[model samples]
Target: MKIQNAIEAKLSEAFDVRILQVENESHKHGVPPNSETHFKVTLVSPDFEGQMKVRRHQSIYKVLAEELAGEVHALAMHLYTPAEWDAKGQAAPESPNCMGGSKKDPAMNAQGDH
Candidate 1:
């Protein structure tokens, strides 16, 4: 909850948002129960209107660098302008189920592995 709040506060402060969702999707993944390590952020803002996809992701990554570096294992981002978000019915794609790894590796932080 702390990480989620921090992310929301930082992004809301930095951008002018029409709609924002910071979801802790750790449960949908295969991480330990209640772990705040996976997330999905849907941000609808005018700031993304003219930005490229890579740039949008980079901006978010930079803002959540601290969380991503330690607390967060993966971040699924959905960035859009208000128009784009409205066009899509204000919905983001659901995350897929996680398939656990056969061999455990501490540094293997795979988004797909959850």
Candidate 2:
């Protein structure tokens, strides 16, 4: 949980955070058990009020650059301002199931077996 802790700490310090959830989703991916490679973050802050979606994402990327450069392989971010969160009924969209790695079903492969 070191990486997750770091992410939470950094983001909280960088923004006026209202609600923050840092989920470790590595188990849902192809990585080994207990890995810290995949994550989903739900961040609601007044700081995002004037920022575009890309800008919000870029800000987070900058804050978590160390984690991203190391073990974190994927980050799914749900960012919202207070008004947006209220409009969305205080919910972030669920992350889709991971489709990469050897765990992919053969039938779902884009190319059929040779």
Candidate 3:
């Protein structure tokens, strides 16, 4: 099975998930071609009903220990319980570009005038 599928399966078994979206975001990062090293996961599950954000993330990390150690280099997670997801209209906001020119470093552009 593919890495993303493996991750989804593991999470599904560990939680009573209502929604799950595992996106391969390696292409957006500054990595070698065909690198399946990074990902973003958006999951809404009943298991997270009364959990804090940190706890929710910890639970997911615990379930994905093997993938975290072996295949995945980086993971950006947006986890929510069904109620929380519904409160926000069940839509996840778009992620802004991280590696490209979207973020400008002041130190890098030391010359004040652009």
**Each prediction's TM-score against the native?**
0.84, 0.89, 0.81
Candidate 2 residue runs with Cα over 4 Å from true position: 105-114
Clashing pairs in 3: none
**Cα-based lDDT at residue 112, candidate 2:** 23
For 48-90, candidate 2 gives per-residue lDDT tens digits of 9889999999999999999999988899999999999999999
lDDT of each: 0.84, 0.88, 0.81
- For candidate 1, report its TM-score: 0.84
Candidates ranked, most accurate by lDDT first: 2, 1, 3
User: Can you write out model 1's per-residue Cα lDDT over 1-114, one digit (the tens) per residue?
Assistant: 888899999999988988899999888665667789888999999999889999999999888888889989889899999889989998988877655461254355443343
Q: List the residue pairs that clash in candidate 2.
A: none
* Model 3 misplacement above 4 A: 100-114
**Candidate 2: Cα lDDT at 63:** 94
Predicted structure with the largest lDDT when compared to the true one: 2
Tens-place lDDT digits, model 3, residues 1-114: 388889999988888889999888876755556767788999998888878889999998999999999979888899998888999999887765655422265553343211
Task: Tell how far residue 82 is off in model 3, in angstroms.
Answer: 0.9
